[model samples]
Target: MMQYRFPENFWWGSASSGPQSEGATLRDGKSATIWDKWFDESPNRFFNQVGPQDTSTFYDHFRSDIQLMKQLNHNTFRTSIAWARLIPNGTGEVNPLAVRFYNDMLDELLANGIEPFINLFHFDMPLCMQEKGGWESREVVDAYADFAETCFRLFGGKVKFWFTFNEPIVPVEGGYLYDFHYPNVVDFRRAATVAYHTMLAHAKAVQRYRALQQEGQIGIVLNLTPSYPRSQHPSDLQASKIADLFFNRSFLDPAVKGEYPAELVELLKQYDQLPHCEAGDAELLAQGKVDLLGVNYYQPRRVKARANAVNPASPFMPEWFFDYYEMPGRKMNPHRGWEIYEKGIYDILINLRDNYGNIPSYISENGMGVEGEEKFLVEGQIQDDYRIKFVSDHLQWLHKGISENCACKGYHLWTFIDNWSWSNAYKNRYGFVQLDLATQKRTIKKSGEWFADVSRNNGF
Candidate 1:
């Protein structure tokens, strides 16, 4: 007796990035991205020495992959254009072969009745730009805007939905605060600078897109991790507020409201960590607000007041303001080691409705990844019942939001296939189709078949 159904013309698909899914990292006049160079510098950093070049070969096999999308009843599919592949030097001459490949891919998707959602940057920066300080440099920001403009002019007519960046905060956290991602450094000031420039680049790109008068919607994808206080205690509440301000509002407010949060700005000034900004930057941001938003929700963040006072002599970081507190008896994703809180998705949508003017948005990524998923294989098909339940539970909440008139549009999974993750490689698979790395074979999982039915019925 399933009753919940998504809105008419609701989008159903999965998301992927060029570096993760496309294997031709260096072919067809493509230049090296940071991932390729990082792998070369430190092979031991990635899992089993797997590199960016080892992917699902989507660059060559996109025709068959689009067919698989039709079979799965996907009315939409999202993928990113590799900046290095499109413009080998990041801001100079364009690559004709890369242009042909992307044009063909977009055309094929449209030909099969699948809408193409294209993102400009997905953590894959060209090595030349990285050498010149990456996002930390305003020059790189300008270069990125040029790259984005090139994309809009080249593909905006065919691709109606455009995203400026995917999970913009991830790079800031990974490369600056943590040492997991490339250019790994432990400098909060540098992280702030990089984050500021990324938003600036997004704004500039939005400005460029508007100037072109392209008939499409442009937005940014943010992984909104709802911060929950441990209790109603004032200290815990304050901690959670600060975490939300630093992690979520830092980019959300600027991208949506075209301004940074006042509290966030004051905190940065207090810590003497405010990033350098040039003249007209604020105006650029204010003029370039997004037309749509893409939200990627996977888990909630639990936080509490700091247990100890910070030493004034130590370097300042966002962690100085609060502490992560793992709640006991919380549901957990065993394979990915992340807490599972399905209500977080609903909370995010409602927050947007009440606080952010109900900006049009969609669930850009929501999925569960399992380690060694092949264990569930039976008769050459994976019975991913857990993933099905996970998606259904989240969709039920999304339907609730839509019913309440939350401007939510669609739900796209984290991935279309088991593509290669940066450091984790293929350890945690989060795809409806199983990709056999050895054979390059694609087999639809049981969840894939069930998802197709849900899509065809527009409900479950």
Candidate 2:
């Protein structure tokens, strides 16, 4: 029954972040991040008033979690280092406790036969740094590079896989364009600035990693949403391309090719929305070319030509170029309300193969988040057969991509154990192992058991 077999040494695990899992935020010399400050200032902004402190407490229970990962047959996992936890001030002396914690955590993972993929930034900016305009300031960019260099010097011996930023555009979208995150600003120009500087910070991190001569791979995690036009009309096709240019190529080009797309630059220039760039930024971006890439695919974006003319007085935004088109009869995840386009995964891989040189890559984060998951629990366990099908269906396409010479090396689910999600809080659970918020209890769901077999067999 093993119809799809992955290549040898395929990465099989999940991804989580410190802000969503680690509970002891204020203790142990860790300074407040934007999450903490935002939650404190406006608790109602979070779902059910759940703050960052309400998590699965991975800080105290990582040992058991690692054991659970072993049981699930995970060969690798990805998590982020909280900047506020590592460097309390984001630029000053490194916290001794933070160093000890990371060292022990990495050593424990390695000892358990699990490879740790460390991501430097996961949208957790230190409060102090945010006061200095967060990613908008060149000073914060320099501080981020210093923080990255400190991490390389301290833990480079243990972690062989390092990522600069996880979905670098989320902060730009959430904080600047949308009102979902902290320091909410509804300005397209500010969002453009944030996106540019974040990539600049990433390039600076990559430059530092290479300069240190560390024996490892450095890359960035991009949540690539493939754009599909509703029709073959020229306007629809152009709309789709513009959406792709604004969302995907904005980060992907600079991260992989070390340069911005010419079309994108020209478009920005036409709109007068280009971010301020320094003299040597072009060279720095070229140096930031990644050795690997982590692709996080959740859903496909459907777009069509704008139905109505935009008001000339309205502020500039990516949406002015296109309108979201909902295709008829598209498959959907009933629980999460996201489209179930399994082929999107393969399309992304083939795009990388044909266009982006087939650089070494992997499915960094993919999973189905279901609300009210406990309703499906039976006999004291969650019978998440839906999740099992979701993974297998995606993997079949992934296997096909690999067979066709795509260089995707591994697959990591969105998470291992259900942890606190930002703003959504525990609204949607996307994990093989379900975590009980009240008692901090973790139980492997049916999908976890199924994944263990798939991982053991290298496929199914």
TM-score (all chains, Cα) for each model:
0.99, 0.99
TM-score of 1: 0.99
* All candidates: CA RMSD (Å): 0.9, 0.7
Q: What is the lDDT of residue 408 in candidate 2?
A: 98
What's the distance in Å from true for residue 92, model 1?
1.7
lDDT of 2 by residue, 260-322 (tens): 999999999999988898999998889999999999999999999999999889878899999
Pairs of colliding residues, candidate 1: none
> Which has the greatest lDDT?
2
Worst 10 residues of 1 by lDDT: 312-321
Candidate 2's displacement at residue 392, Å, is 0.6
Model 2, residue 119: displacement in angstroms? 0.1
CA lDDT, candidate 1, residue 49? 91
Candidate 1, residues 145-187, lDDT tens digits: the string is 9999999989988999999999999999999998999999888
